[model samples]
Target: MIDPQPDGHLPVAAEKRTADGTAPDLEHGRMINGGENLWMTEIQSVLAQSGTKKTTAYLSHECRMERLPHSETYLGGGREIFQKEKPWEFLTYTQEGRIYQFGNPAVMTVPPSSEGDGTFPPAFEIKGCNSQAHCPDRQIYYFDYDEIHERLLSNQISVRSLFLQVSWSTGGDDWTLYSPCRYVNFSNPAFQTSSYIQPIAGTVLMPVGDSFVPGSIACSLNDKGDHIIEASSRVFRDMAEWRIRQEQPPEVARKSIRDVQQVMPTFFLSQDHIIPINGTVRLYRYL
Candidate 1:
């Protein structure tokens, strides 16, 4: 639920912290990357004032509850978060609406020693859902928390029933969109299907793209010889070595399983403001 100041938000930017307990005006302040004085407070204020909300009535008209149709994003990728090292590191790379999250710098370390937190928890989402009969790629969607009242009105089990969708109702000049990831747990008695679990010590361990920066067993370096990127790989190895040392990861968890489904997943239904089959308009459709 981290919000933002009224304007100017994050990802892949400079971060400079100010001293003396003063806050920078994000609306006009300079960008800083991973600094103590990062514009968190200012950003929070913005998110509180401008978060998207979906009312029950809106849900009824849109029929977004119950059945959310599938798209290429989730057509096969069940939950890509676990596969990614830094899923939360996503930033608004361009106005084309392409979201790029940095890949873990270290791809092989089992559980790395986090410079900050451990690893990102877990999350499942439907990457794209089309609501219109004519436009198959018109609707882009993700998941969000629902309120109790809405769940009662919709008559569903589990506390995590709410959702939010993102598509073409947006316009900006290279805006920065920050979406935090969340994981769901339903196997425990104390935990409901909707109950979420947060893992500590979450941090990005892998680097984006294949081919780790060339490095020696004694040391490594990114293509640029920067140590931060190089050191990250070593840090990621901490957990892996321990696992191998202990022979962990449980044998059962090592296998991947797939099941059959009779019905196809669909969307929430309300398709207003959806740009209709505009060949001129190109959607950088995502998965």
Candidate 2:
């Protein structure tokens, strides 16, 4: 497992730049495993000799942080977090199984200036077919690409079967491939022809429901066809609070339950199985 340090330190050395501030020649930015020490040494030397301005200029102008797969696994690996130019987080909205991005050709065209005026136009053109028909059911979705990177690199769970490639006719000449909701109903003919596929870098999974609760359960199957039930910790902790409610007053119990519900650290998935160890740990299937 590539257990990258959480300090956000670059394990590999920042590449040496030319005197004219161009990037050093490289076929690709890939670095072999166990070669990080040598790279670190080179980077430290450059930083000490060149100081902050040179180092910043080189990284900003030539190098960019990107997530790369490990030598052994195709899933995920260490990633460097960079400060984004915009304050807003990148998000995508989906309408009628089609994705709409902000100010991009796939959705909207470039903003137009008011004719001969310095001010920009009130609105820009929306691209794509059936624009009016596809606007109503649009839902804002968040796909946690960073968390997927962490999960795959950490080897905590199998991500292979968490996604399925969906083939759908957009009423056009060609078909499109999309990753459906994990809890998508397979029996639905509209969502038929979804096959298991490996997720790529920056793959995002949005929640699978009309409304979301604090500890909603999302279900999916693994590559082995084992049902996986994922839920936030708040679900069980709230039950724990409910179990201990008799010892406290009504208001106190209510407060405790609410407190437990508010502190879910993360969502986790487990397979359906009963461990044959000293004690049984039964993981029930959600579906």
Candidate 3:
């Protein structure tokens, strides 16, 4: 496990190359080439010195968005279908607090392509466990870059959106917050010529313990012409309530709740779209 220095900075050796002249692998918290390490180094530096909020802000303004081509086809039923001509590209990163698992304060960066210049930015970064209980593993599944890239290229998975989350702690209590989900265009090529109906409304749920708190969901096109789904404020309130019920340490419970007062609902990848709830659920569409 990785350890933080006394001043909270990760070891400078974390960014150094191995003795054999090969760059360190991501599992070791280092990149394969000198160029690829730039963004990861920046993220680590920001987190160690500036904290989570500033690190998140830096990523938000710097990371580049994927731009896939699109096409339109006319169906026999006098309907038109619009879909992406290529698979969506993305990079995944995960960060965990040092307090857990013997100070596992490392960030894992998985890029879409491992070759070339190696300066690509991540699509999103995730922190903490999504489950109601504190997950001891602290490692996200399917975080391998090769596995995600293969799935996307083979059309086995289609990602409609991505979410960013950050976690922080005070004393011994852990806290997490989420940003609004951003809609992305990813379509299955096999279904490109088929016509499908888009639903106008649905229910949104935030997972807490064994149950879920429900809220209203609506979909519309943003100014950029991207199809977006939004959840009502009820979901946020329910999440706050769940955090309170988790019986956090008294020292940071009140502060954690107060800091997350304006927390937004985070969506998860479910089939062709991103859903507000976890578990197996029916897919909803908004046109």
- Among these predictions, the greatest TM-score belongs to 2
Per-residue CA lDDT of model 3 for 1-287, tens digit only, reads 34545543335574222232111111223211112111232111012113332221111112232222231212223232332442332222223321111111112122111112112111232333221111121222211233332333444332331122223443333333332223323334466732221123222222223222232334333223334443342211233434454678756766665555445422221122233421111221111
Please give, for residues 1-287, the per-residue lDDT of candidate 2 as tens digits: 44334533223333112232222111121221122211110110000012221111001011232334443333246563343432232222323323233221122222221112111111222244221111111111222333333444444333322332221221221221222233332222246543222322112222212211111223343334444433321111122443536478876766665555555322212222221111111111100
**Order of candidates by lDDT, top first?**
3, 2, 1
Query: Going through the candidates in order, what is the number of backbone clashes in each?
Result: 41, 0, 0
Root mean square deviation (Cα) for candidate 3: 25.2
Worst 10 residues of 1 by lDDT: 55-64
Highest lDDT against the true fold, candidate: 3
**lDDT against true structure, model 3:** 0.27
Query: TM-scores, in order shown?
Result: 0.17, 0.18, 0.18
Query: Which is the better candidate, 2 or 3, if ranked by TM-score?
Result: 2
What are the runs in model 1 whose C-alpha is more than 4 Å off? 1-99, 102-238, 243-287
What TM-score would candidate 2 get against the native?
0.18
- Flag clash pairs in model 2: none
Sort all candidates by TM-score, best to worst.
Answer: 2, 3, 1
> Could you give me the TM-score of model 1 versus the true structure?
0.17
Local distance difference test, per candidate?
0.20, 0.25, 0.27
